[model samples]
Target: MASTILVTGGTGTLGSHVVPLLREAGREVRVLSRHGRASADGVEYLTADLLGGEGLDPALAGVETVLHLAGGPKGDDLATRNLVRAAARAGVKHLLYISVVGADTMPIGWFRAKLGAERAVAESGIPWTTLRAAQFHDLVLDTVGKMARLPAVPCPGGLRFQPVDAREVAARLAELTLGEPSGLVPDLVGPTVYGVAELARGYLEARGKRRPLLPVRMPGKVGRAYRAADNLSVTGALKGHRTWEDFLAERVGQ
Candidate 1:
């Protein structure tokens, strides 16, 4: 029997990619979600709520490893605590967490929450690996898509991003799940850094639409953080093969 691996956010954008990779690597995969989704031929989907702490024991039973890809804009710390507690009780050997690049230093609530989650994993007393990645290409597309739908597209002139492919992140997470726990590694980023305005223009070009580009400065400290490149990786820049242009060309361009 293959070793069972539990994934908290198995249906999410990154989780969607990670699950298949785990299966391909000969690990039996279990997904914990609110909805009791049907299981595939080699997959098991279980019901669980992180906030309520229901159904975790059974979902985590006999699982050797956990790839925690489940997170949201809110309640990151609480969710992580619930999972950490459950995993500790269940005797899970290795735990891998997914966090965004610059989560610790960024002046954003979501980042703060993520940093807290990272701390939880570190202090869990269980062996773990936490990988920080640059913004996913899909997320960037979602942001630019909303802006590109109007007469004039407004973009953050100084806000920079290294939009990485989710598959790459998933691949790295899978590697971590199968290996010994490494505390914190260098950030995985895209091949190039792009300002938001440049990305907005790329989005327009991908859709074959020419729109007026309004470069605007972001307001507030969070905006200042972005302007100062707090969102970018400083030293450990593990470059991903895919770029914003590649994603746009394949996904958006007709």
Candidate 2:
């Protein structure tokens, strides 16, 4: 089991943490990335681009369990489908995937793509488990931080976010990888939920910046979905304990 575990997106936010934990547990970890960088000692780095369907079969040669985390701005479904096909060809045992909480019902391009990817996973014929998680705290804060530079920062109204920590998600993924494949595990969310405006203010406070908050009410289906708080999983697994404030204090306060 240890020698056959392969983690895609090994250089990303969640994968960075997941790979080390796997290695530390004495699992022989192999990473497949476009950049192909060595993250840990004795870990193998395989080159592949899922969307292009290049170099995947070789990567899956000896890999049994694949923790799929690689994604991009678009073509998420294509990438996942490619990987799924390759996994099936390689006779992979279990496929673990990372997805967003609202991917199933949300009316957005990214969400739709993610949902499509989920379908591909389900139909792949590989024993699979997918964990839908709330937004990551770092991603939320990064967005807010980028907008905080403007004189007036725009905030979406009635939008609630339960931002989980990437490391916390990584830990859960590790646990899932170690265990048997349970199809579509419960969502992993943050300890608390906060409005977008509240998160924006928190970001401003953490960065020691003062900007006028311009509340925006979005005018489309996507905006309506956000307004309805579709992103918050009230009855989810809620595995993450780190709050946005905790993330801010540790990452931004430093």
Candidate 3:
């Protein structure tokens, strides 16, 4: 029997894509979530809180591989530290973590938290792989969708994104999870880089809506980091096939 692999945040968007791929590979899958769930589709569901470190011992018992996909706007460092401690005690062989591109470069609180999470995984004393990915098309869509609701969209100049499909990231993660630990793999990103204005315009065009875009400069060091494209992986990155336009066409224009 294939050893069971535990996935945290398996119910979220990225996890939604990843869980099935693992199942298709004939691996017994376990998902750790905050709420209780019934086992279905060959996946065992376990209730645990990564942040408060509750129920982890039970969750990690006999699990050799862990995909640490659970994260949030804050406290990711603490949550990851909590999970790593348990994974260590449980004798997990391989630990995989999903982090964001520019987690170490961007001067933002969320980025800092992600970097901290990365640190925790690296220091966990277990074989680990961490893949930093660019922003997902779904997340960008939400950002632009909310912006479209305003009369005139505040398009922050120098704010750019390479929005990749979540499914593509999931596939990559599944491939990595099944293999040996490869530390800090090359980043995964979309095929094309787009300015924030370009992304917003694409969304507007897809929805058949019209909105004037106000060009505004982002201030402070945070803005400087964006302007420098610190959040992008323009070189030495594995690019996904789908473009922002393709995603918009399928999700909005259709």
Candidate 4:
């Protein structure tokens, strides 16, 4: 029998891309969803909620590896705790978690939650691998557009980012799920690091709109940490093939 891999948040942006690749690799993929949606071809969809702890046991039964991707937007610690306990009960062999780059160094609440989740996975007694990746290109573009809509793009002064392609990240994640569990692999980053203002300019250019990028000083420890270059990875850990310009041109059209 093929090894079963349970993918949490299987209908999400990254999961949509990942599910197809896992199926193509001939693995039995099971998606944990809340709505109990119909399973995709060569994949199974099971209803499970991380917070409610509902339908987790049967969904995890016979699953050797778990690609844990579900978590609260702001606080992942509680959800991660529940997942760890459930995985322990199910006798899961390996757990692969996807985290953000600079999660440990950044002072943002979201990053803190991610760090807490990483701690849980490390101490869960299940062999685990955690991949910390830079912000996705789509996420960067979306944020820029949203800020621009406010009539001003707020770029934290001197903040740098190495935004990566979500597709590539998903591919790497699928590869990790099939490999041996290693603790905290090297951070994955994009081809280059660009200033937030430049990123915003590129976004506006793609949309054929001109907008002033207002560099503002955010007032808080988290804002200060975000303004620092420590949020980005300088050393290329996981090299992405696509560039930001390429992504924008292909997706948004030049």
Candidate 5:
């Protein structure tokens, strides 16, 4: 039997892409979902709750590697703790965690929770590889879409983000799953960074909508951290080729 790789949040945005890649690589893919009825070719679905620890034992059976992508919107610290304990109990050989960049340096509540989760994974005694990647392009699109829903789009002044392609990130995670569990590899970031306002404009243009973008100067340490140059990638760790322009162009053509 081929090694089964369990992907938490396998139906989600990033996981959807990762699942296919793993299947293509000839690895048996098992998805842990709440619904547990969804199906994909070369993959199996199992019902499991990360928070409640339900159905994990059966889902984890015969699983050698786990790509843990399930987490709350604002970083539920409790969920990570529970997941770490569950992975350890399952005797999983390698646990791969996807985290955001600057999670340790940022003072935001979400970052704090992520940091706690990272700590838990590190101490879980299970072989683990934690990857800190920049913001996703889909997240950029979501931000713009939310703004378009509002009366006006508010762009944070001096805020910049190095947004990466979800497909690229998923590829890296798949590669890591096939290798030895090295703790906390180098950070992954996009080829370039762009201001939030400019990105919003690009998004608006791509979607064939021109909305008034209101740039606002946000206060606090979190805002400062976003504006800081250190928060972005200055050297190559894992460099992505996709750009916001490419993402927007594809959107425009669609």
Candidate 6:
């Protein structure tokens, strides 16, 4: 009999892509979410709260592998710690986690939380694999979209991004989940790196709107990190094929 795989945040952007791939591979999928859903076909949906550490035992029962994709701006460390304790108790064989590229180097609360979560997964005493990925195109779109709404978009000096497609990250994660545990795999990044101004230009052009970009200097340690490209994975990382242009063309239209 095929083993059951547990997926946290299976309904999210990346998880939405991952769950289907695992299902198509003839693997049983159990999605743990904050909301309850009726189990259908071969997928099982369970209501659980990783942050609050509630309803974890029943969720992990009979699950051989765990794909932990759930995260947020804060409390990720605590949430992941909760999940790790439960998975350890459940005797789960493989534990997989998705994190951001600058989790360690970036001096930010969010990145620190992500790094904390990574540490939790690694120290859980279970076989584990972690893939630190660059920012998703969807997230970049959200940021740029909000900026476009303003009369004058603020283009922070030295702010740049490598926006990888969510689908590509999802596919890599699904592949990792099915394979044996490989600790701290290579970082996944997009093909092209774009400055904030360049990204805004693409967005404004796609919308057929032009706004004056106000050059603003970033301040403090955060600014230094961006200037130094601390969030980027320039080399020794697996690059995704899709470029930001490809994403803009498909999402915002030519």
Against the unseen true structure, what C-alpha lDDT does each candidate score?
Answer: 0.89, 0.89, 0.96, 0.87, 0.83, 0.95
Ranking by lDDT: 3, 6, 1, 2, 4, 5
| Candidate 1 residue pairs in backbone clash | none
Model 2 C-alpha lDDT per residue in residues 172-201, reported as the tens digit of each score:
999999889999989999998888789989
Q: Write the per-residue lDDT of candidate 4 for residues 1-254, one digit (tens) a residue.
A: 76799999888878888888888888989999776777768789998778778788899999899998776676587777788899999999999999999988988788889999999999999999999999989888888878889777788886788999989999999899888998999888899888888898988898899877787876777667766676887775877989899999998893
lDDT by residue (1-254, candidate 5, tens digit) is 76889998888888988898888888889998777675668789888777777777778887879888877766556777777777778788998889888778887788788888888888888999999999899888888778877777898887888889999999998899878999999888888888878888888877888788887987987778877754676675688999989987886558
Cα TM-score per model: 0.97, 0.97, 0.99, 0.95, 0.93, 0.98
lDDT of 3 by residue, 1-254 (tens): 66899999999999999999999999999999887789999999999989899999999989999999988889999999999999999999999999999999999999999999999999999999999999999999999999999999998999999999999999999999999999999999999999989999999989989999999999999999999999999999999999998998889976
Candidate 1 versus truth, CA RMSD in Å, comes to 1.1
Score residue 239 of candidate 3 by CA lDDT: 99
Please give, for residues 1-254, the per-residue lDDT of candidate 1 as tens digits. Answer: 75799999899999989889988888889998777788895889998999778889899999988989888889998999999999999998889899999998898899999999999999998999999999999999999999989899987767899999999998998888878889887789999999878999899888889989887878999888888888999676788998888898889975
Instruction: Give the CA lDDT, 0 to 100, for residue 83 in model 3.
Output: 96
Give the TM-score (vs. native) of candidate 4.
Answer: 0.95
**Whole-model lDDT, model 6:** 0.95
Write candidate 6's Cα lDDT for 1-254 as tens digits.
97899999998999999999999889999999888789986899998999988899999999889999998879999999999999999999999999999999999999999999999999999999999999999999999999999999999999999999999999999899989999999999999999999999999998899899999999999999999999999989999999998899999993
- How far does residue 16 in candidate 2 sit from its true spot (Å)? 0.6
Q: Which 10-residue span in candidate 3 carries the lowest summed lDDT?
A: 245-254
Q: What value does the lDDT take at residue 183 in candidate 3? A: 96
lDDT preference between candidates 1 and 5, better one: 1
